[model samples]
Target: MKMTDDNKEIIFNNITKWLRDSNFVMSEEKITVVTSEFYAKAYLQSDHEYILEIMSATGIETRFALRIRLPVSEQQLENYENLEPKEKLIFDDKMNAVIFPQRQSINIKEKSAFLEKTISIDPKSIDAKQEVMQNISNLLGSAKKLEISFDELLSN
Candidate 1:
């Protein structure tokens, strides 16, 4: 579905509602919104240090994504890269890898990485709210698990 202004508003409302109801304690002063011909985005930060970024794509991609950034050390990155597939960390086509619950994609960088989950958003669908909530939960869970794994790898 094309991301019209109405669709974008629906998505933004859903996200804000979810954040509020889920007790995320977002900083109202830190919230930001950006819109363009092709996409709409919201960046929100919580008191607990969780950064939630939501983007609705209107162009060819036509999707929605929820993302969070996590820190990683240089040694941890090297350890992750050396893991075998049996360890459940596999390289993507771009060769970036992360340990996870496996529902989200990780884009690793020098010191931090984004763990994101993308899904098709149909504002009019009956399941839209449930899908968005579930994806947000999954992204947070995956990030926590990855952080634990990184700490363990660093200790070893």
Candidate 2:
């Protein structure tokens, strides 16, 4: 959990390489990196957030969480006075990823509310350092698909 400079660089390099390989423009302006005792964070253009956290209990294992935050549809929002209650509240846009145990998510923001979908990973196999970097492309792909779907739905 202790984030050393070398550790931070390793994590940063992994993410940088992945973003570039995935055809995502990785410029100084779009990427933010931070490392602390408990976790390392990488933010991609403020749209994607990836974190590596060591749980309180080592037996519980370390986890990498990738969260893709996309804008909520015009209609679907975070708070409402009159609401439709259902087992699963599916958003009308790409933000409507209600698949549980996989894409666990939530909603909130201000200027434009967003739906944050998170995918958790176990990094024991991939070098712990490269875990988040390795999966970034997959994360972005899913996010891109969601964006496309949102656009499609909006058009219709």
Candidate 3:
């Protein structure tokens, strides 16, 4: 899934437009272009204070990832993973309460105060990439409502 600089640039622009269409504000400074021999990344932010990161592998890695940050913890993630009656909505202020209902997860990587879910994408085909992006955009749309709710919890 290694991507060329040109391909990365094209994808970045398309994602920018998608974010705008979603009514997210991508300030000039919030859209960062980062590239190295092993990776190319786009770090984006919105007026709502949500951040989205898109990464492409430029080395031996066979996949890219789309991730977003969430305020969550490792113990909380473990509990979510261990859910027996997953259909039940159990929320705690310390968990990713908003995303739990959607069955989405935060891949707890040294979960501190924040964690994220990384969805890998096979970037070998343009269609696959497009589909993945569309899927993420759709998910983002759905998550917006819960994100606001989570924000209120934090404010309390």
Candidate 4:
């Protein structure tokens, strides 16, 4: 549970490599790896049925949202959707990243803006962080006709 500096570096290297392997280029600054809060309900309806509600003591969404300035296809978006229900992500066309554990931001013009130099991790990392957590939630699911709650989606 205690991650030493060396251990952190190792994880960081792994994370960085995975991100690059996923076609995300990295910058020399503002790169971080940290645990993210569960924003699951932030994007889910109270009535929506998901293994997330069934398996974890915390229903809060610890999902990852990567900011990318790249134009993503509906198919690319679907790939993240097919991820485990617990693994949620919202990619921005203004930011680019392969993965980071949580979201990071910067204050700009008196408004909080996503740091241009940051990269957030993907939800699939949960399988590495906690297999039991990944197992409880369905990962190998379908994204065909994905159902999204507009209210939940926009609330984030």
Candidate 5:
């Protein structure tokens, strides 16, 4: 679904406000304006920090990705284990963790009764990011529409 221009402007303004109030600090990498979109990066200030990438896709929605430095130390691994379950840690046997899209559902365990049960995320979380992307989409909405010239060329 595409958002209207007015809505896009509103969302962009709201996102900037939220980013400023967030606990994570926005670094130089945070603000990025590409040909068709913009991205925000938030860095955690810790011994082993992480980089959060927020992407507002061209004519789509905003999404987030998290990345940590390589060769995670033992202390960092332990700290990860301490995070609350509500945080939803995604780690393999090796203790590497990353967050997945709220809309995505995947089974973590095999041969379990819950295997068939779908894991879902809160609608609010998805909406927040989706709003960001929709804003970008709205900005490019007119350009995305097919031109009459294209149809005429096709007939020829």
Candidate 6:
């Protein structure tokens, strides 16, 4: 409840364990804890990796927030942008991710694009782990659907 170091550490440890139990590969050495945040890298597969950042503060309505970022390619960004309005809407309906485009001022190329999704966890909830896992599963499924949609668009 209080954003103390001990509470943060406990939550981080629990989340790390949950992730490992769910078959996410992570190295303990890669985990970082700052004063107000915890960061970790998780790999669902060799190619599918995500950055997990958890943050808590005093005044925020959501006591604990977990942000997951999955990197995508420039091609994926292009394909997503080219989708028809209705198709885009359908994708939005299925995925709870915000597409972020990264570009350099000189090059102006969409080289690094990513999907980011945030989940708020009530630390007191008995089903917090289940909720987090379900969110992850849904996110992965949507990512797969996105890939299929890109392939379909390419074919057409």
Model 6's lDDT to the true fold?
A: 0.55
User: Against the hidden reference, what TM-scores do the models get?
Assistant: 0.69, 0.46, 0.44, 0.28, 0.36, 0.61
Best-to-worst lDDT order: 1, 6, 3, 2, 5, 4
Instruction: Please provide, for model 2 over 1-156, each residue's C-alpha lDDT reduced to its tens digit, 9 standing for 90 to 100.
Output: 333444434443554556556445543322223322222334555544332221111122223344545544654333321235541244433244532323544344453433333323333336643545545544555556555655554554
lDDT of each: 0.62, 0.41, 0.48, 0.29, 0.35, 0.55
Candidate 1 on 1-156: residue-level lDDT in tens? Answer: 555665666566666677677666544422234443222233334435456677655553337676777656788888777777765343342223343344578887776778888777777788877888788777776677677767776787
Instruction: Give the per-residue lDDT of model 4 (tens digit) for 1-156.
Output: 333333433444554445345433344323233431221111122312321111111112322322212222444445544545554434321212321222333222221122212222234455553432222122211111122321233333
lDDT of 5: 0.35
* Root-mean-square deviation of Cα positions for candidate 3 versus the true structure, in angstroms: 7.2
- Top candidate on TM-score is 1
> How many residue pairs clash in all the candidates, one count each?
0, 0, 0, 16, 3, 0
Q: Give RMSD to native, each candidate.
A: 5.1, 7.1, 7.2, 16.0, 19.9, 6.9
How well does candidate 3 score on lDDT at residue 143? 47
lDDT (tens digit, per residue) of candidate 3 on 38-131: 2222333433444565555444343345555654445544544454554224434334554465444544344432323344444445675466
The number of clashing residue pairs in model 5 is 3
For residue 32, model 4's alpha carbon misses the true position, in angstroms, by: 12
Best-to-worst ranking by TM-score: 1, 6, 2, 3, 5, 4
The reply for model 3, stretches above 4 Å from the true place, is: 1-3, 27-49, 60-63, 73-105, 111-133, 138-156
Query: Which of the numbered candidates is closest to the native, going by highest lDDT?
Result: 1
- Tens digits of lDDT, candidate 5, 58-143: 55333332222223334443444454665433322111211122222222232210101111112246577555434323322211
